[model samples]
Target: MSATTPPNAPQGLQNSIISFPDPGILLVLINRPKQLNSLTVEASYELDSVFQWFDNEPSLRVAIVGGVGKAFCVGADLKQWMSNNKKGIPMDLPTNGFGGISFRHGKKPIIAAVNGAAYGGGCEMAINCDMIVASASASFCLPEVKRGVTPFGGALPRLMRIAGRQRATEMALTGRPVTAHEFKEWGACNVVVERGQDVVDRAVELAKLVAANSPDAVIITREGLKMGYESLGVGDSSRLFLEGWSKRIYEGRNMQEGLDAFTEKRAPLWMDSKL
Candidate 1:
């Protein structure tokens, strides 16, 4: 939504959405403010390409996913939804899912900057992200049940895992909207910002901090800590993720630079290093 692009971002993506490259952060914005930035079928498919691109491009570090206009993403176009379902189309498809890019998960973090009410799939997109920061004016809900539909795309399980089963069920079943404050209280929103302020600015501040670190170290540390606890029944998935990264760290100069910077009590310089 900001006019200024991140390091390598082009003018903008389709639907006024843009992708800023470099500095490891990709900005995926929904640009249909006139319709409250409603998600269209084409927009959804574009999102699939966006995420896929982010995953394949090694230069990308993290993503800041948000929307344009008054709301972040109001949800699917009901008009489109009615027609699509009648034909036995699957809403869970990769391009039509939240952001039109469902089914793919990124290893890097994605910070959801909820600018307004995120209903239905919008809420699902925010919840699935690695972190969420909402404006004070932001609200969240899953009203799909009211329409005889269910949020089958990861929202139900994620809410239960992150906010507890009771909260998840209450939200899904009742179709009630929750305030940003309540979301923060439930540990679902990492930061609650003020209205008219910049969630993107805050996110970029966080992004720069993350990008300044040793990429390999960050990757390994994320994999290690993400493994959770043995008492929690952690498995080989985390180890498997790390096995590939261990070789990168062993051979990368970024690791040595981080150590040297610490010894010198100076800031790390890693712009040219692999992340």
Candidate 2:
């Protein structure tokens, strides 16, 4: 099923569609198939709002992003960019960055269900997601340098940290596309689906697995993982992480439910995270 707008969703969404595909899971699909899911400036800001709403909504635990057509997202609307340039307008991205996924430091976890070419900012989005589940046919590339523009949406450092400098350098300099399997080897892709498997279905299954766990653990653990990637030293990372999250998780009702359920051999009845 295609993504559709919610009755009271954040406004200004001319593109990108949102829906609750499963219990506790929000699905955001990039809907510009004819344009290969390239995002216009207005659409970029609107998506930032969408994700902000996702993070704020208590019932939603996980989000999956995918494309409606042959490409996940090819990045900026360059045609629009050139038009804006001719008119002296700036094509500024939202503070949350591309599709509100790249450069996002949100509290919740997001999973990218890559079905096709996740080029440019699309690749950026996948790289920044807490996890990625990609189709075998999916490919990733950063062709910004080739287009006479740099990937200014905060992906370079993150990509270099995740995929290593050599691999990152090669992809950026040559704009070479890497297959899903190869990216999995680079530690960029979490799961590479086999041919004929539906990427979104696989991603939904994974998202539900996360949603089933304690929401507090999911957020706290996600913070720890992000710290590992972004922090220079574990001392500072652990100190800051502990100061903020350690108390909340330990004191949270879900923690008690989790341990009690495990001891009793029963399913956990988790509460929504108050963190």
Candidate 3:
């Protein structure tokens, strides 16, 4: 790699593997399959660093995260949580939340590849991703309540927004596993990879499409979308977007290249996102 080119993956990543499956696209695999991809606090923090690096790396415009085994993530390590509680430790999540994604507000977009069962924090991570592609056999649930806890990993409110109050309440209260198709109906899962297909491959395909676009637009447009998704009113969101990223985007060279390419009827040659 050139001095200007960042390493393929961030250093100090022991719990996850990062691969560049396409230009400007990153694929993250949670390495723990034996524990059903359960995360301890340390693992969560380590993944947090990985994503933090992803955000700062100019070349990586999109990310697809999945597990290595039959589960995306089963949430925190319960045994570790119990032990920490007994030892007077908080057993809390990093600011980025479970697997460094549930509460992430990053500059770029991430897609969740739900290859298998996603429970507790795992489900929350998938819930908050910019998009999700789940295999037909994938399952989802928030089972914390059954273990004398609540789904406190930022899934509750986001679920209400995506799936609505009634549906969210039904899933939260019941703590029962649901199929990928059911989640699709709830508007939580974007696409269900049919049987005999790979969820991560589908996610990577989606990521490559996004990566092929003007990287600056992808990031700023994603910010605008989030402002619309999370903010109260469309008018206010538009104003905020115009005041913020809209100005930064116009100042960037990619915007001009995109306009020029369109005018010339040629494909845009976009640079890595600098916005």
**Regions of candidate 2 where Cα sits further than 4 Å from its true position:** 1-12
Query: What C-alpha lDDT does candidate 2 achieve relative to the native structure?
Result: 0.86
Better of 1 and 2 by lDDT: 2
TM-score list, all predictions: 0.84, 0.94, 0.96
lDDT of 1 by residue, 175-254 (tens): 99999999998889999989667987777777767766775666666656545521123557555655756777878887
lDDT (tens digit, per residue) of candidate 3 on 93-212: 789988899899988999999999899999999998999999999999999889889998889999999899999998999999989999999888899999999889899889888988
Clashing pairs in 2: none
Q: How much is 33 displaced in model 2, in angstroms?
A: 0.4
Cα lDDT, all candidates: 0.73, 0.86, 0.89
Query: Which predicted model would earn the best TM-score?
Result: 3
RMSD of 3: 2.0
Q: How many angstroms is residue 68 displaced in model 2 relative to the true structure, after the best TM-score fit? A: 0.3
Model 3 worst lDDT run, 10 consecutive residues: 1-10
Per-residue lDDT, model 1, residue 156, is 81
List candidate 3 segments past 4 Å from native: 1-5
269 Cα displacement, candidate 1 (Å): 2.1
